[model samples]
Target: MRNHTAINTFILLGLTDDPQLQILTFVFLFIAYLLSITGNMTIILLIFVDSHLKTAMYYFLQNFSFLEISYTSSCIPRYLYSLSTGDRTITYSACLSQLYFIYVFAITQFFLLTVMSYDRYVAICKPLHYVTIMNRRVCRRLVIGCWMVTLLLMLPLFILLLGLEFCNSNAIDHFGCDAHPLMKISCSDTWLLQQMVVICSVLIFILTLVCVVLSYVYIIRTILRFPSAQQRKKAFSTCSSHMIVLSISYGSCIFIYIKPSAKDDVATNKGIILLNTSICPMLNPFIYSLRNKQVKQAFTDLVTKLYSSQGTREILK
Candidate 1:
């Protein structure tokens, strides 16, 4: 890995320059970040402690929650610190590290979502074989495979980024260190890097999207053939939370990366990135918990147990 870059630090031109707007943005982001951490952590805790959640579906949900926390943390805290301290300079190594983790977590999320869709497919379409197909060993392997694939895919691009020479400009237009923004400021011939990025992104996007679509196609077909209306509703309900999450995730990423005009719209891209990193992570736990009866039941039971334990301790005192 060659570090040929002359620039050691890059200045992030954050969301806004106005003091009032920065304050407002800071407050909003702080709240969102706090809620996102709390919510995703709660889900992880619930899955860990609740016996009722010891299933393949909940197993994947737990991993997904962890990813959400990691993904948001990878960039949001740095930006918050920058906003609060008026320190926008990030070291080159730190910026590259952030860029790597952000991509890893984000890309892994897409693969995980695709895995989740397959889990649902097996559960709904092949109910009799669901347990055998998505056993503990298989689920664990799937999660690990997602991480491995992401790392392998990102390694080349990251290596290329490491060799980039930034001579003219050090200003990143976005709040966080993103691939495109970094490339935008590089003095190196970025034609290869850009092509590699496009190829990797399109490959990941299309492959996962095709899997998700095929899974759902089979799932919908199976649901429709169910004889009873209640059965169809029940089947659809089980997958509803996953479907919603998939839509939000893929939709935001598509808008930002896949759209023909997205690269030219830097301001709009930043807005979308804020929403994707902060708001979406914050909303996911609520979406699942609200829609999932099993998770709700588990939460109620946990609360009741904790309350009872506290009361007993008071009586003993």
Candidate 2:
């Protein structure tokens, strides 16, 4: 066992050790971060301004957009700074805060995705009762409940991590502070913390995945029973975008967190985290909007309104 002492700061090794690669990485990440922020912000603004989008589906989407923005912000700016300045040192408190938020957003995303699957299920399987079942009050409650439960589940884990003592090693092999790396660096015995993380992660993944799977199963069944081919196609289209997002989200998550041997593959893990934190968020808005007709129309309408407003302002001037 290493000597017990408090660690005041931790160094992130970041994506690469090559100086040229670091500059390239900074540019790439900056562009990706900008795209993610713009895309998600556009989705949120469109949903808010368009009365036609004031439905349960769009409501959940707005929440997801906000979550993506916050999730990416929690990790990417620090990473960008590290790449730009060659300074990978993060204060201890900042590391803890980042770790706390990473867990909260990640867990909340799973719950929210599961909720979205259920919403799709209700909309497809019980079309006649969609509005009645997914009422405004219920949607609000479900969103609130997802946030509340994720926070409650992650708080204890964060508190447990805070109690740990880090001594000799303060270098994290990844771009951001995560549970496994933090555990590996700490001098104190982390068996309890590790067990808690493993158990909590498994439970969250399994429970949410089970819910999504069951919901989709029913959804597929309901779609198949529809007499009209066009109707089935429409229903399937509505679901395909979500199914794609779910697969990618859960696939990356399972590989990163659930795999027993994941720790040994630090390079692959960091690559996956980069994709998850940056690329995936950047893709989400485009995936949903391009696939959904309503969102495209809303975007067009928004642009038209902006142009018209500009014309009106010119006339007044």
Candidate 3:
């Protein structure tokens, strides 16, 4: 549909065009989205209720959870509706909005993960100064700075996208409206937009990854200085989960943006996006919360407190 005509609506050719497959896809995505929502909310609630969990680490974790909930919600619900109802048409404004917020939140993920790495670095490499360095005011400023930076990074790209004319081809080959797919269908030359995306990707992904690597190097050195093997294992354990989460998140993102052409294989692109948007968010809660001993203890304590309260109320009655 690309011959110099403005497109009002786009049909998302989503993961599949098959009716049976659409039902299965809807079910799968629905369940995944539900789990992601539940898990992330649990993390946020646990951190908020448990004073012991209130630290720079959990503060970042709460922010990450909120971002994941917003990030996945941006696309999954629309995709599910399209699959279930067989109505894949999305308005131009709606598509652009989704694209905008997805990029916004995705960029925030990079920033937050970088911040988490720095927090770990301080906690492990400079334990004596950790509290002083990562104070409440500092953490708040860092998070606000992340969102501000993301807004600056995305505004130019949004303007560039606005200038492009979407002619006849209105069918997006993937599950949602991404920059690459939109560029492919645009009648205008996408060189500038492509360049902007590449530049920003490098700035966000590569730079943050370098920071995380450097932080870990210092962390490892500090851990090794500890005399006891048990101490070393305990120190590493604190960071191991975060590192795993970072790998999965960054690995998927790198594959998506580092490629010469993301739209070359529509099937592969959609599958990779599913992993990034759906699967990865779902994994974050488990990776950080379930595995952390403090979180488990907090959950147990909360449960016990609630139970005792209920028992007391029954006795009073």
Assess the local accuracy of residue 234 in candidate 2 as a C-alpha lDDT between 0 and 100: 94
Q: Would you estimate the TM-scores of all the predictions?
A: 0.97, 0.97, 0.95
Error of 3 at 254 (Å): 2.4
Model 2 residue 193 CA deviation in Å: 0.4
Which candidate number would show the highest TM-score if scored against the true structure?
A: 1
lDDT of 1 by residue, 102-194 (tens): 999999999999999999999998899988999999999999999999999999999999889988899999899998888998888899999
The lDDT values for all models are 0.94, 0.91, 0.89
How far off is residue 294 in model 3, in Å?
0.7
Query: Best by lDDT, which number?
Result: 1
Report the C-alpha lDDT of model 2 over 1-317, residue by residue, as the tens digit. Answer: 43333778899988789888888888888999999999999999999999999989999999999999999999999999888777889998899899899878878899999999999999998889999999999999999999999999988888888788887788998899988888888878899999998899889999999999999999999999999999999999999889999999999998876676544588888888898999989999999999999999999999999999999999999
State residue 100's C-alpha deviation in candidate 2, in Å: 0.4
The candidates, ranked best first by TM-score, are 1, 2, 3
Q: Model 2: number of clashes?
A: 0
- lDDT rank, highest first? 1, 2, 3
Q: Which residue pairs come into collision in candidate 1?
A: none
TM-score of 2: 0.97
